[model samples]
Target: MIELAAIATEQRNPRSRHIDQVSTEEMVRIINREDHLAASAVEAIIPDIAKAIDLISGHLHDGGRLFYVGSGTSGRLGVLDAAECPPTYSTGPDLVQGLIAGGESAMFRAREGAEDDESLGKKDLLDKGLTEKDVVVGLSASGRTPYVIGALTFARQRGAATIAIDCSPHSPVGACSDIDLCAMTGPEVITGSTRMKAGTAQKMILNMLSTGTMIRLGKVYGNLMVDVKATNHKLEERARRIVMTASGCSRDEAIRALGQSKGQAKPAIVMLLLHISYEEAQKRLQAADGFISRTLTTASTEKGIR
Candidate 1:
């Protein structure tokens, strides 16, 4: 029988027993205490995370895709971040892709033993036609998931840039990748249960990495999501408010500009900033590559030159 076939596949920390029989109130307090360790673990890895960011930002600036590969909770986190990119920053879905171990089917229901197959990991990446220009980020809390390790190894063979995220500083996942982020959250309250503190740290790091990249890509302006897509009612209202808040215009004026720009927050902002017609605003934005700062800078520069 496969050794893992009969096991629960979860690591239990020996220390958990000391608290398992404790009062309910204490259980929560213990969990919360464990949670604090996650931040510090991430704090220790900031320099390494920054290194990945610097490399990723450079790759993306050259027209490369940022691919996230993971399993279970990590996979879900990647997919969540990738899905939000389009609506939050008006980026194409193709720009940020998430690959889960069991594919889309695993998103809703857990697939049996999906994370144990290392070959599947390599195939999933190869199927996407990952090239040298693409960057693949493999996430595994234990830093020993066969699926994640296999992906990193495959990426290296293909000359693609690879990054790994794991909780243990001595994790195999860290050793295999070019940029390994070992957050070092320590032993879980429940022993090997990484879904607790380790998961939180991974989520925070992923957010930092992706958010920082978006900023450098010019998706944000002065801390605002200037390029948000107003696809739903809530977002449409937000788009109106973004323009109104930025331009200090009446709600009606903001709504009008948003409608004229097809509910694109950045283009609407440009229209207000230049006091120009929607057509001219859009043309200018296109020239500036949808960057609000650049759009505004070019307009001010041109006016001065004239």
Candidate 2:
């Protein structure tokens, strides 16, 4: 095992040395103040994050898949982000996937020992049928987790694009990846508790990568999730509202268009705005590669619609 004390994430914070001696309010304030550093650390790595986003977006545009591999809190965050992509951007389940060291059961509780087994990482990724067209993201706060390092190494050997997100500098994970987003969040307030600042930084970067890629793929329309899946009552309502917001139409008009488009927000909005049939709107969207902005602009110029 590595000497945890040598890791940046496991080091003690100078500001919080006496946290246990302080009052509850003081302790809370100390933690919150230190937490502010996480955002700055993430901001410092925006260029690297952008590179990963573009690579992933290009791969996905070419029908490639995205995979996130990690352990503990890092793994859970990746899984949460991947699971939300389907509902938010109406993507397929296979579009973005998350793999933890100890499988699904590890998500609910700690699987500390699983992270030490490097072979399991490669096995998990191989089971997913990873290919050259795919992109794999490795998440590890310390950037030395055997599981994450193994996955990234295997991904590179398979000719896939690999990205590493970590909170420590000069990370081994970074060395094995095509793009390394090392957000130096410094030491944790609680000392070695990376689930605090490190986890927050990872979550922020993951959000950017996934959200930016989706936007590039035309899942968003003017800041709204036009491709959101209306699988539940709340989402259905959101779909209606999105149509209304995008088309500048009345609630009734939006509802009617949504019904015509089978509850799809993008088509419904396009149909209402272009005053076209649902079938025509769908064709335009398909021709535009699912980009509502481009489809509407092309229709306006060619047919003088809207």
Number of the predicted model whose TM-score against the real structure is largest: 2
Per-residue CA lDDT of model 1 for 1-306, tens digit only, reads 324222222445455668968999998888898799889989987888889988887788788888888898888778888888888888888888888899998989987389899998899989988888888999888677788888888988988889998876656677878898888776778755667888899899999988888888878878888888888898888888888887888899898888788877777888887888888988887788667899889989999999
Native RMSD of candidate 1 (Å): 3.2
**For all candidates, what are the clash counts?**
2, 0
Best by lDDT: 2
Q: Tell me the lDDT of candidate 1.
A: 0.82
The total number of steric clashes, by the backbone 3 Å criterion, in model 2 comes to 0
lDDT of each: 0.82, 0.94
Model 1 segments more than 4 A misplaced:
1-16
> Where in model 2 is the C-alpha error above 4 Å?
304-306
TM-score for each model: 0.91, 0.98
